[model samples]
Target: MKFLPVGYNTQDLEKQAKNKWRWQWLSECDSKGMKWTDWLKKIDVCGVAYCTFCGKTINYKSNGKKALKLHCEDGNHQKIANVVKTNSVSSILAI
Candidate 1:
């Protein structure tokens, strides 16, 4: 039982291409036009959001439960996280 960290490099770059479908999953989300709140929970899709102190992946659950705090691994998300919490992500200005 092993779970790879959000980002790992031990895998050979070429053969590991098997998992390169992340972008395609994201593209699928784009094509569906689902709400960000809904799409964020679709599983198999992860993301990276950064600010001064946060360099970690987001944590979300089904039915819109969220605790996207910036922890030791996901630290400085105060500002950006606030923006998302306050409104639909689509309403935000491009950053």
Candidate 2:
């Protein structure tokens, strides 16, 4: 027996198209109405995003912006965001 991957299914491929990642997502505000552009960036890979704050990679594949939203709400991400904010402020003040 053989199993087909989601990419091989026509309907799944169509769904992937509908859920494709958009560069605009990085500029859009999160559910909390906070912009994450300073930490979020597009990966060269077809449907992947990178979070510089936590050094995390997010694969949107068929989930699109929902994946990004979840990443923003993740506890670890929030923790890292605070750390980044503190570090930047201290570094600036040191100058």
Candidate 3:
């Protein structure tokens, strides 16, 4: 009897590829109500939206903005936000 090689499933590979594509598409297209603030930026990885500043990830399918807001409200994110705001103000004053 001859058997196929172990761990060689074409269907699984195809499914993974399809899912990756779908996630990429969703990340590119799904950005409603997401503000482009210095404290956070939308980054999609494997179908999840993440805050670049705070390193927080959220499901794009479930209220990504809310998660971002929460992160921004956190103490660490707040500190970064304050620093960014201060720098902007300083630059504007220098100009």
Candidate 4:
């Protein structure tokens, strides 16, 4: 998927202006009934979030949950998330 930075266009700016961030989005599960709270964190900013797995901030000012879903679906994010999960499980088993 094409990655566009926040405020890349007029529409993004408008959306950013119109919407404030929701704390509940971080706790809510996606349509697939999967929660991402393990790796997703809310920053102090209004419409930005941090992904622990990818170590990147995401802008969801306009799209909200859809934006987060897309981020989670991104190839790089998925790969990192999977690797982290593997390592975590392996570490737990070793302990």
State each model's CA lDDT, in order: 0.31, 0.66, 0.42, 0.66
User: Which residue pairs collide, candidate 4?
Assistant: none
Preferred candidate (TM-score higher): 1 or 3: 3
Candidate 4 per-residue C-alpha lDDT over 1-95 given as tens digits, one digit per residue, 9 for 90 to 100? 23233333334323444455554565766444446876777665557778878889888777777788898888888787667766987868899
Q: Model 3, 1-95: lDDT tens per residue?
A: 12223233334333423222122222231133323343333332333445555666544334434444455566776665556556877868889
Model 1 misplaced regions, further than 4 Å: 1-14, 30-54, 57-95
Please tell me which model should have the higher lDDT, number 3 or number 4: 4
lDDT for position 86 in model 3: 61
Clashing pairs in 1: 53-76, 54-76
Task: Identify the leading candidate in terms of TM-score.
Answer: 2
In candidate 4, stretches whose alpha carbon ends up further than 4 angstroms from where it belongs are 1-17, 28-34, 91-95
Q: Per-residue lDDT for 88 in model 4? A: 84
Give the Å shift of residue 89 in candidate 4: 2.6
lDDT of 2 by residue, 2-92 (tens): 2222233234323435466554665776555557786776654556668877887877777888888899988888887767666987878
At residue 26, what lDDT does model 2 achieve?
Answer: 53
State TM-scores per candidate.
0.22, 0.68, 0.41, 0.65
Task: Report model 2's TM-score to 2 decimal places.
Answer: 0.68
By TM-score, the candidates rank as 2, 4, 3, 1
